[model samples]
Target: MSLRCLIVDDSARFLEAARTLLERDGVPVVGVASSGAEALSRAAELVPDVVLVDLDLDGESGLDVAAELARCVSSVIILISTHSLEDFQELVAASPARGFVHKSALSARAIRGVLGENGTGSAP
Candidate 1:
């Protein structure tokens, strides 16, 4: 089955581009959110198979958001960032998120790699 996806980012531009790219790459984007509250609400309502959360929100911490989602939602949370993975390596390792994907490299294949590394399988 195709994995349903939810993308959470504060940038409208990134959100649009990401949704388009993921959809084109055969990942069904079920929803998008710009903030922690909106992300929580959407996740609850959508119950997606995976969620890509930005590392830095406008006023919220993406790590915190990921933690909450990991606790409440059954979805595999993968943190995405414009920053280098080495810069946030420790933090990402400590986070409840299944893995990290740089925004520049965001793709269905990359996401599946993360899931596979976490033993979550490649598809839902």
Candidate 2:
């Protein structure tokens, strides 16, 4: 079955890029949000299989959203961010998110791998 996904990012360009990539790979993007609050509200409605969230949201932190999402839904949370691991260690320690993805290195194949798709890898 095709995986359902939700993307939460503040950047319009990044959201568009991620949407294009997921659509091309046959993953259905159920929703998109520009902030943590929006993502939280949408998650309850969308009930996606996976949630790709940006750590730095417009108002609140995405880590906060991920933690709340874990409780609200069964979706696997994967944080996408430009921050270093060291910078986000506290948030990572507090959340139940499944993985962390760097925005600078994000690609369709890598995203596919995160979604448990076969034949996709971290390297492009």
Alpha carbon lDDT of each predicted model: 0.93, 0.81
The candidate that wins on TM-score is 1
lDDT (tens digit, per residue) of candidate 1 on 18-119: 999999988999999999999999999999999999999998999999999998899999999999999999999999998999999998888988878432
| Candidate 2 residue lDDT tens string, 55-96 | 888878788888888888888888889887688876776688
The regions of model 2 sitting more than 4 angstroms off are 115-124
Error of 2 at 64 (Å): 0.8
In candidate 1, which residue pairs clash? none
After superposition of all CA atoms, the RMSD between model 2 and the true structure is 2.9
Clashing pairs in 2: none
What does the lDDT come to for candidate 2? 0.81
TM-score of each: 0.92, 0.81
Assess candidate 1 and give its lDDT.
Answer: 0.93
At residue 78, give the lDDT of candidate 2. 85
